[model samples]
Target chain A: MELLKCETSDIENTEKYILKNGEKEIGYGYIKGVEINPIEIFIYENERSNGYGKLLFSKLLEIIKEKEAKLLTFDLPEEQYRMINIVAYSGGRYISIKNGVRRYILPIK
Target chain B: MNNTILKFLERHDFDLSLIKKKCDLGVKSSKDVNPIIAKYYIGKGEEQQRIYVADIVGYDYSYMNLDNSNIIDNMSYFYNENGDGYSTRSLSLLDIPTDEIVYRLMGSFTRDPMYLMEADKGKYVIDSNGLHRLHILKAHYLKELSELEEGDAIGHKILEDKYMVETMARKVDYLKTYSSFLFQQIARYYGCDFDIRPQYDDYGELTGKVTIELRGKNEKLVLNDKQFIKLLKDEIANFLNDNSISKKDKKHFIDFVGQTIEEYDSFKEYIKQNLQEIYNECFSDEVEVG
Candidate 1:
């Protein structure tokens, strides 16, 4: 996936990273804070499963690691099965389930 | 250490741990050494907290503790390994609903209104507890939004997806706003002092005299007037040579400055007085004026 970095000349607060495969925006993703958690992320609908989610997860993890937070917990909505699958496939462990959302915890080390 | 530094650290709740560390570093016995140690400890705490030292001024609140009812789960709360509250600013700017805010102070003391942000941490209160904090947030948000590519999405309140743009075109009136406060904070980070005051007129445009002071004695530290003037002229020349500034503004300022060059009294003073007006007209968030 190609990364669309924010151009300082035409600065944007939009998605920090716009994921694309060739000409199409296969998916777009950005970090959202739940608390100080960098575990919050969004991935758009797409069928291409070429490890982009893993790449995106790793990128987001790098940012969180730079923060004071050591480990990040992913609060994934149950409906987003692809994301859940990606997280699980990438060694994300089920931390807990609460309020209709499943939380996955990962140590960024 | 001066009382100011001691009080600053104490107010922020960093005294105990920081003092402990300073003691470990052989700081206690050293006379007049608290400020140095305090500065070191503050830097360490600032890094450990993952909060930007710059954003220290941008947020204000009182602490409710890790177990406080005010603490919400899954929301990003930042402390300076201490307090002064936390921010998850990417969500939105300050939305404090209550006027009274509760903050945590370590050590024995009754709570009263104090600095929105203490030097070493201490307090976790509402982001809206202080007016200065709110003002900082507003200016910050404006500056953030101003540079973003959201022109088509102007007035849209959505911050995440589209990243809201400047909606106030003609309604872009604000108080005698300027950048001195920000400058001072940045200067402090660099271990210096800066004072800035800029006046504005009834129309929300900058007016009257402006004062800027950067305190230092070293030769390199003192700002040279001629060099600064030359730099300003070059920057403005480059800016006007490029996109967006109205020709009318460029010429009006030029003509006004030129007319009284020989006598160089009233009109020159007027031009000098109105430099900020010209700048605000050219740069402040408003419809481009010719």
Candidate 2:
């Protein structure tokens, strides 16, 4: 897998990182705010179920650690069971489920 | 905290627990401090509870004037360990300066409403509710200023043309203050870069064609001024229509943008009536009438 870092030009403090496999973009995710607030990860419909989501997620976790962020948080739609599973497997703590979304947080270490 | 608001909260039997005494940067003037009172709906469906937060602004209603005189004067508030409202890390994350924020704050009135919350002895701070919007506005403001500066440095010959220079300088001066407000409403979702050049004919007279380069996530659009405005409006409308954004979020965005645009139009009208002479006075020495 190839890692491509996008620009941090946004004043909103949201940056995107892309994971590619031989020029075919597999997945992307956003790391938001200086606080390293809840992140959003997406695996293209055509690229799902192939473990790329997990691969992209692991890479993102490393980035959060490199940034020295205290925790990794996720606020995702409840229907995203696969993503919830990945977070659970990675030790994300259940925070709450509100307005059709599940919120979780994982300490950096 | 204002006495009237406090009495109202007391009369309503508002739980004191909802009010957090977190804004402690140490500025003791009451007028300088604007209290933040935010409402949150915790949980969902049957268990949902509505809570009004005083002093500490919640994330949803966190729109604050981060560069407000009260906040800037008490910058140390962001460095405190217990102050969860804002942190030094968050300020550094955006890497913006106090002066720049103050400049942006002048035009952020409608975009960021004042929230009143008294805590820690007449001390209060703005929260991050509309942080993303403020940052977007700041981004557009800074980006446009930088572009104008670039034109100043590169288009020397363009400025030498007295007639053309007069018009350009006036527009540049107008944009220095107001362009960001105008662009923020429509260009909020797009990444834009401008390339303004002094177009010249065979005889070397300036024709004044400025190029705007707009980059979206997957495409690059190059447009002149007229085309750029029309296309940008159309594209943003299409984005609002096609995207899966929640109705509440969409309405919030539209309402804020609509108000700011009105402010922008009124300011432009004011400048048209009052600032023309001032612009001429400021730029007269810089242009060569030959």
DockQ of each: 0.01, 0.05
Per-residue CA lDDT of model 2 for A52-75, tens digit only, reads 777787887788778877666666
Q: How does candidate 2 score on lDDT?
A: 0.40
What is the DockQ (computed on Cα atoms) for candidate 1?
0.01
lDDT of 2 by residue, B1-290 (tens): 33432432344343333222222222222223211111100111111111111222211121122333232222333333333433323433233332344344444443434322222221222221233333323232323333334347544332222111000000121221232233433345444433222223333222333233334344434444445445444554554565554555555555554443344453434334534432342234542111
Give the Cα-based TM-score of candidate 1 against the true structure.
0.24
Indicate the worst ten consecutive residues by lDDT in candidate 2 chain B: B162-171
* B125-215 per-residue lDDT for model 1 (tens digits): 1211222232323233333333345463643343322221111011101111112222332344336664333322332233333334555
In order, the Cα lDDT scores of the candidates are: 0.35, 0.40
Displacement of residue B168 (Cα, Å) in model 2 is 68
Model 2 per-residue lDDT at B139: 30
